[model samples]
Target: MTEQGPVELIHLADSENSVIVRVVGATSAGLPGDGCLIAEIVAASEFANGRLTEVYLLPDDLDDWAEALELLAAGRTVSWMDDGRNPEVRIELKGPYISQGQTLNAVEVEVRDASVSLTAVRVLVRLPDDWVDAHRRKLDQVHKAWPLGAR
Candidate 1:
């Protein structure tokens, strides 16, 4: 896993603003995010002035989020960490972008961290229609790096 560096839990971006979540390491020995294999979550977004927050996300969160991405290729709207404790992401079709010489549907994204300060950023991002495929691969790598109870 070191060869590839950290796993990108999620990367939603556009021309100006972007949101990226990187899985840092495994959670504490006993405590987990409801059987969460991850510990540190690094959230960043240009839209949020600079960085958002480095919170924790349990394995269940990643599992459910992955499931949602699996259905993303079907033109579905999905969300993750929307509980407000962590950086929230809402993705849906918006416009278009050019990738691999093909035009693909864009994703209008909102990366918000409402931690009492009352700040939220919403921006349009151009993501490939099949972006889920890449996302799933990243999640697989994360699981391999930080399996349940492995720390």
Candidate 2:
């Protein structure tokens, strides 16, 4: 993502500590590929004060969670809401990692938006990773019950 400047809030949040941003629109030159991806960010600074937090981005329809994994891998954005008022969100990759650890995994992305003022929403996500041998073995066993073609 080129240094395209600060991301503007087209659909601002309701509170100062939190804001909900989604992919309202996008632009593509269609050459080198990854054009301009946009999202309406809903973030808050004071989400909570603790360790081990779980955030959910619900979908509008019934679909597999694998879809989210696919989107994140492809650099496409998504959100929890499906009000049918905007385009599908592409995961915004342009943000700062809040964690100060030497090595961080599945860290949240924080952005400086005028809507959220001094606060920001902590966007935490888990990307795809390799499955351990033991886990894969268990999955192999489970798959046997619902084989490829057993109907």
Best by lDDT: 1
Q: Please, what are the lDDT tens digits per residue for candidate 2 over residues 15-124? A: 22333333323334453322323344444444452121112222221132244445645555555223433322333443333444532224234443333335433554
Off by over 4 Å in 2: 1-64, 84-91, 94-151
> What tens-digit string does per-residue lDDT give for candidate 1 at 60-104?
687778878866767788877788767677777775667779787
**Residue 70 displacement (Å), model 2:** 0.4
State the number of backbone clashes in model 2.
Answer: 20
In candidate 1, where is summed lDDT lowest over 10 consecutive residues?
36-45
Q: What are the lDDT scores of the predictions, listed in order?
A: 0.65, 0.33
Error of 2 at 139 (Å): 13
lDDT of 1: 0.65
TM-score of 1: 0.75
Error of 2 at 94 (Å): 5.6
Runs off by more than 4 Å, candidate 1:
1-4, 30-48, 96-101, 149-151
Best by TM-score: 1
TM-score of every candidate: 0.75, 0.26
